[model samples]
Target: MLRYILHKLALIVPTVIGITIASFAFIRLLPGDPILAMAGQHGITPERYEILKEQYGFNQPVWVQYFDYVWGVLQGDFGISVATKRPVLTEFLTLFPATVELALVAMIIAVAMGIPAGIFAAVKRGSWFDQLTMGVALTGYSMPIFWWGLLLIIFFSGYLGWTPVSGRIALNFFLKPITGFMTIDSLLYGNWPAFVSALRYLILPSIALATIPLAVIARQTRSAMLEVLGEEYVRTARAKGLSPRRVVGLHAFRNALIPVVTTIGLQIGTLMAGAILTETIFSWPGIGKWMIDSISKRDYVVVQSGLLLIALIVMAVNLIVDVLYAVINPRIRVQ
Candidate 1:
């Protein structure tokens, strides 16, 4: 297991390098000069533009710039955000916790709802409950996240006033961001009102972000569970007078998790992608919103570095999921 994990970790360096190269090329290919964009409404004189280019090494050869960029990244410098004039890494770190919190809550909703719906569906098979759930799952899978988020806002926030329309929490409280994650920070400070505020703010966005992933997880789980439930061991356990719950939950669900786990892992990328739309709709302060703002401003450093960091995070999640296979089944570890 350790050897396998080490091997996966070793592979990440090359993968990250490839991602960086691709992202750098892509960001450059994007039309508009980041320097000029950063100049804003006041704009810049051509003479000033040349000096700014020289300062940022835009005057250097592409190869030299790439090497220098890589070197800076290795030293933990992601360059300064042209828009904000803050270190790109610092800007990312400050905003990342919100994204993490949103994604985590969304995943929890997906897993908590999806797995059981799948298990029940698999158990019930062709029943009305199964049919209805699968129908809803299909709707969820096909629904546009942004549109869905808007509908939710219209109903829950606009009409009912049950939830906040946008933002992480009510701005008036001014909770000091210890962890940057509002829910955790609220709990740590023992501020239940703030905690409730944070949670209320989270629900719409979390549900909006969760929909597609929940559908995917449910469908994957059902498919995996169906296959596992038909296996000889499962039949043997049933014939041996094992309780149906134990046979299904303990044996079938455990065995079925391999594919389900892979699906869940793949959904990390989905969640991040969906976050862009979800954050925009909800005005959630997260990497997605930040990246969009950076892109419109043509802040090359933030765009490139943010893409690389998100890619790295996805790869790390995939690696972690791969490792879990051995733990889940034990047969893979033996092999």
Candidate 2:
């Protein structure tokens, strides 16, 4: 297991390096210059432009710039935000946990809702419950996130006025960034008002984010369960006088989980990247929101850093799935 993990992690290093190179190159190659982007070059002089370039090391050769970027990364320097003038890493770190918390909440809802619906559908193959659950799942799968967010805002926030319209918390709640997750941090600090506010705000975005993945996971889990529930072991468990529930739950569900877990983990990575649209709609302060802001402003440093962080997250999730597979299936254990 250790050997397999080490080998997988080693592969991730070069993958991240490649991602870093590609991100750096692509952001630099975008239509506008970062200096012009920051300076808003309406009436800039040559001397001033040169000074900005020299100051930001934009005048450095391509090779030198690459080395500098990489070396700065190695030393934990992700550079200052070209837009905000804040340290990119610090700025990102401040907001990243919120994204992670949101993603986790969405994943929880996805798994909780998807897996049971899937199992029930598989268990009753062609019943009313099956049809209803699958239909709902399909509708969820088809709903566009932005449209869904708007609908949620219109009904839940606009008409009902039961929840806050936008943002991570209500105006009256005092924020204490304990773990950077507003909900969790609020709880830790004994701030019930903030906790409730954060949770209520969390629901619409979490549900919207969960839509496609919940459907995908439900479908995959149903298929995998359908196949596994008919396997010889499941039949044997039934023949040995095991309850139908045990046969399905213990024998079939366990094996079916491998693929479902894989889908869930992959979906997690997608949520991390895809949250940009969702965050924008809801005005959430997360990595997604920051990435969008950086892009609009052409903040090269923040853009590059944010992209690299996303790449790292995707790779890290894959690595976690790989390790989990080895742990669950024993056959993949390193000799």
Candidate 3:
């Protein structure tokens, strides 16, 4: 396992490099000069702009810039933000926690709702409960995330006044920042108002992010459970006078969990990707919002560094999923 993990870790460097290169090229090929965009052309002469370019090493060839950028990243220098002139990493570290919190809550919602629905559907196959649950899953799978987010905001926020419309939490309580994740900080400090406020703020976005995954997990879990329940071992367990719940829950569900675990693991990657739309709709200050803003402003450093960071995180999650699969099913490692 250690060998496998080490091998996977070795791939991170090249994967990050490739992501950096591709992102750099994409941003470079984008129209407009970074320096000109930053300094503005209104009152600047060609000479002054050239000086600015030299100062920022913009006069260097693209390859040189790319090499220097990679080296700078290696040395922990993500470069100054054109928009705010702050270190790009510093800015991201602050906003990333909210996105992670949203994703975590979404995963919890997906598992809590999906697994039970799946188990019940499998046990009561072809009944009214199964049909109704499957129909709801279908609806969940089809709904667009952004549309769902807006609808949630409208119903829960506008009509019912039950949830906050946008942002991470109520601004008034002002919980102390710890690790930048409001939920964790609120709970850690035992601040009931802040904790409740943070949770309320999270509900809409979490549901929005979890909806599709919940449906997918439910369907997969149902299928997996049905297959396991029909297996010879399940029949044997039942024939041995074991309780129905034990036969299903202990024998069938454990085997069924392998696939469900895979689905949940893969769901993390999707949650992060989905956060882009969910964050935008909810005006949540996360990596997604930051990426959108940086791209619009053509902040190359911020964009490239952020692409690397997010890609790295996604890769790390994928690796964790692989390790989990091996643990849950030893056949993987035996090979």
Question: Which number leads on TM-score?
Answer: 1
Candidate 2 CA-lDDT value: 0.87
Which candidate ranks first by lDDT, i.e. highest? 1
User: Candidate 1 lDDT, tens digit per residue, 1-335?
Assistant: 89878888998988999999998898899899988998988989999999989988889999998999899999999898878889988888999999999999999999999999999999999999999989999999999998999999999999999999999988877788999999999999999999999999999999999999999999899999999999999999999999999999899998898999999999999999999999999999999999999889998889989999899889989998989887887787667
| Cα displacement (Å) at residue 65, model 3 | 2.0
lDDT of 1 at 132: 95
lDDT of 3 by residue, 27-67 (tens): 88888777767765466788988897887677899899999
Better of 1 and 3 by lDDT: 1
lDDT scores for all predictions?
0.93, 0.87, 0.88
**Model 1 vs. true fold: TM:** 0.97
Angstrom error at residue 23, model 2: 1.0
lDDT for residue 159 in candidate 1, whole number 0-100: 99
Let me know the TM-score candidate 3 reaches against the reference structure: 0.92
* Per-residue lDDT over 1-335 for candidate 2, one digit per residue giving the tens place of the 0 to 100 score: 78899999898888888998999888878787878878774757889989988988889998898889889988989998877888998998899898988889988988998999999999999999999988988998888888998999999999999877779988887776778989888988888878888899999999888888899899999999999988988888989999998988888999998898899888977787659888999998899998988887878888888899788878888999988988889887844
Off by over 4 Å in 1: none
